[model samples]
Target chain A: MIAAPDSPGLVGPVVLSMKMAHRTHGEGATAVHALRGVDLEVRLGELVAVMGPSGSGKSTLLNLAGGLDTPTQGTVTLAGAELSAMDPRARARVRRRSVGYVFQDFNLIPALTAAENVSLPRELDGVGTRPAREEALVAMAEIGIEDLADRFPDELSGGQQQRIAIARALVGPRRMVLADEPTGALDSAAGEDVMRVLRARVDRGAGGLLVTHEPRFAAWADRTVFLRDGMVVDTTGGASGPESLLAGGGRHRGDR
Target chain B: MSIRHGIIALLAEQDMHGYQLKVEFERRTGGTWPVNIGQIYTTVQRLVRDGLVLPAPGERSDDRADVERFTLTDAGRAQATVWWSTPVERGAPARDELAIKLALAVTAPGVDVRDVVQAQRTESMRALHDFTRLKAAQPQTDDLGADLAWSLVLDHLVFDAEAEVRWLDHVEARVARASLHPRPSPRPTDDPAAGGAGGGRARRRSGAPPPGGRRR
Candidate 1:
């Protein structure tokens, strides 16, 4: 007997069902095919990095995966549920319940404190305010910034704000995290910290799709997918080691 | 890698036996490169034969003996000074297998250059991660000279790996561009001067701007 589609042991990809999907903007001669016949799948506990030059449909793919945008053709399935098949209200519920997004700009509300920012999603999902706040604090602590829970976004540094944003994304039971250049605005050291946090979260069982141009950042992912002209050009199968490009073994030859 | 000079530099501090020298060398370099005992003995023997080093008095002559201490002579000290002052020669490029592989991959029939680059990149990244992790584990102390030396060596490895990854990216982009717009074959009878001038005009006609332009 087969396990039910939504059963915990079903163990299919967290995000799937983009077959020959296309996204177009505008109309007639001015139409821009932002994404063309793109197909991808991100499994649970895996972090897939999407790398490409600008306007190569990296963001479009992320948007589609996160259910923020619908595909022109084909389907998108999140957590084994077909997104396009759901009504607007049901789709919105699925997105809110299953998806989390980390943006480059650390899209946090200025008015809400760090805890409030992180807890808002849980509260919106009908969780009690106290429990949401407690969950938010736990998330903040997990990212190593529990002390900043009461501080507003303005009080935090760019790295701190990004961490808070990550905490917000991870606060609830969201299992699919979509990061769009999450480290674009930060310095290298802070960027590394963010990557580490993201990697740890993904390792804890969430699936992720990271859109980045930096190979160093992409190295943090389990696999890197290369996109060009709105299509998958190549994939490194999570084996793109930083030293593979350099000829020579790690050993340095030394004569006595 | 220049163990001869490295031994001389170590002797400049104090006289040491072959075993001690080997230990010192490995210690300073954080054991990234281990020198063979035989090799060390040979290097020391050559140094003594050249009069750059003199065997310390009261040491055994037996080749297998560990009691043979050596010290740098005045000339050897001068040579060490010169070695420190002179810049390393960069005239001869080292044989880089990655470069050769990529060159061949681009021209060889049915060979996927991208796959080669990607495979190498994966190895490079793993090496880089190992190096970085090693560097992080090293204790940072102001008073330890060996720590400083090892850190420098690790930094070299890190930088080299970083440069390799960047070059791979460059190769990938260049190959992609070249495939998109194949370059015209050179005319055998064309004048070098005329071709040079015509090439500029041809670039403009092809809608490819100069380097650092918006087209890129």
Candidate 2:
């Protein structure tokens, strides 16, 4: 029942902020207001979940927070850098160097081997082929996938491919990881394993933002932030455990 | 997630029977995920079919035919590694049935909040009772995990049920303290969202439970 208090002066060390106003697409009456006065921050090294019903702007919020899209009005500041003001090239660089993305589809290159997939990110950054491959092997080993490096995506099972996708995201240097429905493709058992890997990443001083529809998946996060209709409704206090998150959701006031 | 991964994770650590794997899976999950006896046997069959797990010959004979031990293959170990490394997206928790149900109960008139609460209480109690009986019937020689896991599952179920029951009681108390017996009103004819034509439903279905008892 510990709720995060709303205070402007009080800030977490890693404060990810979205301040004021609106975000819209089309002109006039047909405009899509994706965000309306979203003022929220996530602390450093914290794993947070952004949950809401369909079309509630949860994904839009994530896109704005991660610098994937721009807000028509307001600012999104990550680590004190105002992403909204950054140029396209700078924004792409920031996203590539600062943020890691994990998509639900695994998104692995079908033609590439597991090791090659993990190494591609670094190679794109001008890192040497041998060094990148070495680093990829290490990252794969960290996630318990060193032995499957040579196998192609199609050669591997769904779980294996997904694991490679995760390894790929975590391979290069990045401060924060953002995953969109990482476990949606897997069954319950496979999904649980994927969660454990994410949890381990958090334990290693990495911060992550996950957008999921699964309570079981959200239970692993340090905090669960509820959103409704383009506004953050509630946030379970930053507590790293499963029971509180699940039980707290059940006990939600529902009035808000 | 694949039960194959579960089987591999278990057998990779050590040899175990179907029942043993079920106990370990529940233990790892803090008993939040329940696996039935039938599911355990069926998963084992699938694993054997996939060549991920195979029988440990002469591990048990006579009377223990149903207790066949299983071990993972080299390929299974490789599969386990890949599974452990997979990346997952982190997202918000979705559509909470309990929250929605409570919201409806509080806002809707003529809704029997008591019936819902009572039904939940009865179901939870039966589960708790069944868990207790199973625990008592299990052999002393069974692994500690089987005993500990079932206990944790029962604890969560009981505690959750109590929290819900307490909430229901609080609602009733609030209503009684205020002595708020809402005056009955005439039923509306039109569907709230219907634009025109014959409206929504073909039949008017009452929100009432059938006779006899609660159904799962």
lDDT (10s digit) by residue, model 1, range A1-256:
1111111112335555576778888889999998888888887767778877777899899888888888877788988888867887888988998888899999999999999999999999999999999999988887688999899999889889999988888787888889989999998768867877787667666788999877667766766787877988776644333343223554442211
TM-scores, all candidates, are: 0.72, 0.55
What tens-digit string does per-residue lDDT give for candidate 1 at B14-61?
Answer: 999989999999898766677888899999999999999998777758
- Where model 1 places Cα greater than 4 Å from the true spot, the runs are A1-17, A26-31, A151-157, A239-256, B4-17, B20-31, B44-64, B67-162, B171-183, B187-210, B213-216
Query: Model 2: per-residue lDDT, tens digit, A79-118?
Result: 6678899997888777776666788889988888999999
List lDDT for all candidates, in order.
0.76, 0.66
The candidate scoring highest on TM-score is 1
Please provide TM-scores computed only on chain A for all of the candidate models, following their numbering. 0.85, 0.83
Q: Worst ten-residue run, lDDT, model 1 chain B?
A: B207-216
